[model samples]
Target: MISYVSRRLGTSLVLTVLVSMITFFLLSNSFDGVVRSILGTAATSATVQAKKAEMGMDRPVIVQYADWLFHAVRGDFGISYFTGQPVGTAVADHLTVTLSVVVTALLITTAISVVLGVLAASRGGVIDRLAQGASLFGYIVPNLLLAIGLVVVLAVELDWLPATGYTPFTENPGRWAASIVIPVIALTVGGVANLSAQIRGAMIGELRKDYVRTLRTRGLSPGSIVLRHALRNAAGPAFTVLSLEFIGMLGGALIIENVFALPGIGSYSFSAALQGDVPIIMGLSLFGVLFVVGVNLVVDVVNGWLNPKARIQ
Candidate 1:
């Protein structure tokens, strides 16, 4: 298990480095454009040169990347070109908001998907059909559309939740939940649909295995056999689906954040890209790559725990 974890960590580290290098090079190649955007169209040639040199754009790409990576390892991402805020501070502020919605949605998705999936697999009649149908409907509907509909019904019409805005949980937990509910629902719908389907399929397959029959013959209760045995085996695939949903939620949060006018990394990154804020962009890019790598590592470890065979693989 230790060896397996080490290998996974090594792979994740390598992937993070490769992705950060590629992103740095791609952005560096466009340094002139970024500098121009920052300085404005009327800036003189010498002024641009001075600005570039000041920002270390005049340094070799590899040297700049090495320098950035060195600081980044110590959690110093420099200052945003546009906002003058430390990149790490800016990203962290927004990250909290994004994580609140995404993580809540993920927890809800997992619980609801598992219940629906297990029921559908075990019952296999009207319950199954309804679960499948709901899954299909969710899969068909785009998150943006659903978010709009939810805002109209729950926020605008019903006045039950806030349509747009965010409140820090530290400030008021009640308002925080109210502000985040719609966004979380929007993000969760598709995740629940996809993960529930995967879980149902896995559970069904696990139920049909010879071991299930043997367990039944030993007079184990149906609930015990399914919950303790079948579900455990089924969870391997479900975890994979859940991890993928987490990554998808991060991407989806970008649009959801804008629609709801929430402060999140997604919205911040979007504006940073538009303004050609190299420090902000580079910091966000590195964060995104590292976030994905870290999530994948967690998923691998969880999968290994669920299925010992996965550790060997």
Candidate 2:
């Protein structure tokens, strides 16, 4: 297991380096050329060169990537071009807000999926129909529409919560929770539907297995057989889906954040791209690459633990 984990980690590290190199060179050259072109020929060559040197544009592409990798290893992601703040500090601050929203959504979605999935699998007639209908509703509703509906219901009509903007958890935990609650729900509804579908399918398949039939013939209690034996085996596929969802939650939730006006790395990246803030965009991209790599590593370890056959393979 240890050796397998090490191999995965090594592969992830190498992939990250290659991705970083390609992204950095492309961005640096593009930005530098733009800057030089905009300044014109009469513009001070010395000043342009100085700015290039300052931004590490004057370095060889390999050297620049090496420097970036070294700083990234040290948890110093350099400084944001637009924000003028250290990239690490800026990302850390906004990331907390995003993390809170993502974690809350993940928990809520997990609860909804697991309970609904098990119930739907076990009680297949009208209950299964209703669950499938609800899942369809969730899957079809676009996130922007869901977010807007929540804002209208919770903020405009009822006035139960603030419309948007983030509150520091330390300053007022209650308001902080309230501010993000709607957004979390809006982000997680689709995830709940997808996960529930996967979980329900797995449970149904597990129920039809020979081992489960053997248990029934051996006079095992239905509840124990289903809850203890079936659930454990059924969860392997669901676990993989959920872990992949976790990684995607960080990078792919831009629309939800934009709808709610919650400042996060995704939103930050979006804004930076629009304005051609090359440094911030690059930093955000690098952050996402690392986040995905870390999540996949974790998922691999969990998968190995859940199925020993995976390790053997």
Candidate 3:
């Protein structure tokens, strides 16, 4: 386990560094534009030069990356071009909302998918067909379309939830849930569909395996045979699918955040990109990449425990 963790950690570091390098270079292409955004279009040549020098933009791209990486490794991700606050501080402020949305969506998706999938697999008739139909609808529909439809129906027509804006849970729990409900549902639709299909298939396969029959013959109840024996075996791959869906949710949150006007990383990232706030953009982008990588590592660790054959050398 130690060896596996060490290897994954090393790989994650290498991948993160490479991603940071690429992000730096890509942002460098707009280095001049960022300066313009900072100083505005009317600045004199001397002013531009001074501003560039002040922000250390005059350095070679390689040196700037090294400096940024060094600071980043030390938890100093630099100051935002627009906010003027530390980039880490700015992200930290909005991180809570984004995390809350994704985490809520993940739990909801998991609960619904597992219930539907297991029921479909065990029953394998009308329930199975209904589950499949729902899965297809969710898997195929575009998130933007669904989000808009939801906002219009739930917020405009039904008058149950707000269409836009956010309410921090700390301030008002009921309002917080009301505000986030639409966006979370929109973000998790595909996740629920995909995960349910995976779980259904995994459970069916596990049910067909010889061990299931042995357990059944051993006088275990049907629910126990399925839930205890079949579900546990099915969970490893379902969990992997869920983790990948989580990464998808993170990416999807960007769009949902914008759609709902929530003050989360998605909104923050979109604004930063529009204004060419290099520090904020870099910080948000790297945060997302690392988040995905971290989730995958956790999944790998879990899989190793579940299936010992997957253990690292």
Candidate 4:
């Protein structure tokens, strides 16, 4: 297991570095052009040159990427051009708000998916049809639509919840939870729908295996057969879906955040891109790359443990 983890970690680190380099170089190159287009006739060549030098854009792409990577290793994510604050510090301040909604969404998604998936697989007639219909609705509707619909019905018409903004849990946990509840629901609904469908598919596939027939002949309780025997075998695919969903929650979801006015890394990245804040954009992209790589590594390790045969392969 240790060997497996180490190998996967090494590979993930390399991928993270590559992603960071690509992101840095692309952003650095685009920054000048974007800034130029916006500045146009008002900008002088000398002023632009000076700005480039100041932003370290005068350096080669490799050197710029290396410098950023070095500072990142030391937990210095550079200063935000817009805010004049440490990028890491700004991200740290907002992480709690983002995580509150994301974690809640993940938990809800996982719990609801497991129950609905198992039920759908166990009962193939009306129950399966109902589960399929619900999953389809959640899967087919885009998150932006979901967010807008939720805000309209729940916040505008019903006045049951706030439509936007984040409150720190430290101040008032109840209100903080209340504020993010809609966002969480919007985020998790799609994930739960996808996960449940995958779980149902895996379960159905596992049920067709000869071993399941043998278990039935052994007179094992139907519950034990499904939960203990079938579920263990069916979980591999569902696990992948869960991992990808978690990684996605951390990085993207900008549309949802924008629609709901939720303060998160997603909105920060969006703003950074819009303003051509090279440093912040690079920093956020690097952070996202690391997060995704780390999540993938963890998923690989978990999958390895769950199926020892995979380790041998």
Q: Find the candidate with the highest lDDT and give its number.
A: 1
Candidate 4 ranges with C-alpha deviation above 4 Å: 33-43
> Model 4, 1-313: lDDT tens per residue?
8888888888888888888887776776686765565457589888777777877778888888888889889888898776788888787776666778888899999999988898899888988998899799987998878888999999999999999887888899888888998898888988888899999999989888999999999999989989998998888889999998887766546776777777888887788888887778877777787778877887788889988876665
TM-score of 4: 0.91
Superior by TM-score: candidate 2 or candidate 3: 3
Q: Which consecutive 10 residues in model 2 have the weakest lDDT in total?
A: 32-41
What would the TM-scores of all predictions be? 0.95, 0.91, 0.97, 0.91
Mind giving the per-residue lDDT tens digits that candidate 2 earns over 1-313? 9988988899998988888888887776676654565455566878788877776678788787788778888887777665578877777787888899998888888899998898889879988888898789888997789889999999999999888888889999998999898888787888888898888899999999999999999999988888898888988899888987777666556877777788887787778776666657667878888888888888888889777887788
Better of 2 and 3 by lDDT: 3
> What value does the lDDT take at residue 291 in candidate 1?
85
RMSD of 4: 2.3
Candidate 3, residues 50-93, lDDT tens digits: the string is: 98899899999999999998989899898877777999889998
Q: Name the regions of candidate 1 deviating beyond 4 angstroms.
A: 305-308
Q: Ten residues in a row with the worst lDDT in model 4?
A: 32-41
Task: Candidate 3: give the clashing pairs.
Answer: none
Q: Rank the candidates by lDDT, best first.
A: 1, 3, 4, 2
Q: State the lDDT at 145 in candidate 1.
A: 99
What lDDT, from 0 to 1, does candidate 4 have? 0.83
